[model samples]
Target: MLDIFRGLKSLIKISHIHIDSAVFRLHYSLTVILLIAFSLIVTTRQYVGNPIDCIHSKDLPEDVLNTYCWIHSTYTITAAYRKREGLEVPFPGVDNSKSYSETERKEYKYYQWVCFMLFLQAILFYTPRWLWKGWEGGKIHALMMDLDIGLCSEVEKKQKKKMLLDYLWENLRFHNWWAYRYYLCEVLALLNVIGQMFLMNRFFDGAFLTFGIDVLRFLESDQEDRVDPMIYVFPRMTKCTFYKYGVSGEVERHDAVCILPLNVVNEKIYVFLWFWFLFLGVLSFFTVLYRILIIFSPRTRVYLLRMRFRLVRRDAVETIVRRSKVGDWFLLYMLGENLDTVIYRDVMHELANKLASRHHHGVKGELQEA
Candidate 1:
């Protein structure tokens, strides 16, 4: 309890976020927080109150009622039924007319498994981000942060561009070689999404087997204003057999139904998560492509910066930056780095104007010589 309070106090002491957090990290944090909230509070509430409520005989003895509830809670009966099948003793075989259906066996723990899977999903998403942060956080991030600060502090445009060019040449090349390591993290993130699509399908129902086409089918069915049992996030009820207990150790039996309220919550949670994973999966897919283009091909680099920053002189940019000098700068910029593109745009414009002036002057000199 004291430790909990200490942790809360430390959180209160936080003034601001120093490091620029990425999109994936933010998503991972939200996922973990929601998982904790639902597991600890939402699903847990269903287990509160009575575990078993016996019915049938209004005048059933209180002792027998309590005993039945306790016994039924012991075994996990899913969905099996028997009908007054056992022999009853004439002595203390006073089998109460009341009985409860208890078909689910040991499967009572399934609701908790939902929480475990969601928690696992959140952790898996974070794994790649942590890997990238571990590699980039200490080295590339710090260096880019310093460049961002220095570039901003400079007053002269020439000095600012010079600083950027120096850093672009000196540090960016070394880091760009290892940039694929970061993309490996993106690959992991992409796999995490793809994996969840199938994982949820296997765990809950077959709807996820189509990898999102099933989700569309579910929506179309919803337009008809009908419930589709096939698309439910979790299995709600299961079948099991009730053990008829009385004097002489046994008496009667009946059909039973095991209700899981967690299934209701699971339906809502997984539906949202399924779509969420799809969105992230698509985004990660393209991010990998762009990362590849920026690293290996200079022409591709120029094209992306022209589109991304909306620069005017693509031809000049293509001439100025061959491999990844500008590509490296733009690459870090796109990955939630603190660098400002306004400075880069201004520098590119100035360079393009200079190149244009030199070309015009050379053309005029050639005409005079002729």
Candidate 2:
């Protein structure tokens, strides 16, 4: 048991001792820097804006205010706006005009939640790679090499083992990294799409219209009681219309009360879509760029090329040895002829001389023996 334990310890030590100084350290530093920067960016910006204000209240209708309230209660928005007129507003609901069912809303909400979960998952998935790279005895180089080769093989196994390693090494490296980052960005893009869709549908359906109607009603009701300052001007404006020869003329006065225009809702939806498209496009573009970089970069390209050459060389050598015993003399000759010209010439010359001497037999053999 002690001998077994001692052997295991020695193996572990040997396995760990072959670390790549340059690549490992560079990757470690980069991982640490990116993690710190990402964390700092998320953390320091957290409290800079009012959390309640982020979601546009104008995008929410009065009918489904309860749903909005529920969402807000769970996840805070950074900003909100209050309409000046006081009215009993029901919880904002889905616009009846659009006829969206409860099931659809639930599904949309669920999709949003899934997106959020994916974003969280992406962060979690990235954390381990960062942590592993940062750790002291992490064997990052071996991990990278394994990623490059697509499989782990014992170094000592030549022929068949080397062939397997070479095959894996060429095709796997870029694909693994691409799959990870692509999924992450894709999930984030989907989340943005869902959130934006919800906001646009909510705002345009009845939120702005309801707000507009409420304002118009308030103005009309106040005018009936002569409590409205604008009410007094109607008579004068009417008289001015009579005096202006069949045209209604009025004072060039504007209302001081700020009306939140419905156009703002349209603009909000436009901006949301624009940003959503832009972000997704950028993410996709970067993914493609990284893939190209992996393909074209000197180190990666050279590594892939070398792996391919090794595969070819191993296969050629194996084929020669396999057929040499079988009477495939023609195939063996072809292979030998195709080998590196200088090596082929030297090998052929040596073999030819040996065969000639063997046929000559006793004359050369007796001279050498004497």
Q: 158-256 in candidate 1: lDDT tens per residue?
A: 565665555544554455545666667767777887887888777643545553456566567744353343323344443334445666787656434
lDDT of 2 by residue, 242-337 (tens): 011122455332111111122232233333334433454455456445445543454443343234334334333332322222212222232232
Query: What would the TM-score be for candidate 2 when compared with the true structure?
Result: 0.21
Total clashing pairs in model 1:
19
Off by more than 4 A, model 2? 1-46, 52-94, 97-100, 104-119, 127-370
Each prediction's TM-score versus the true structure: 0.62, 0.21
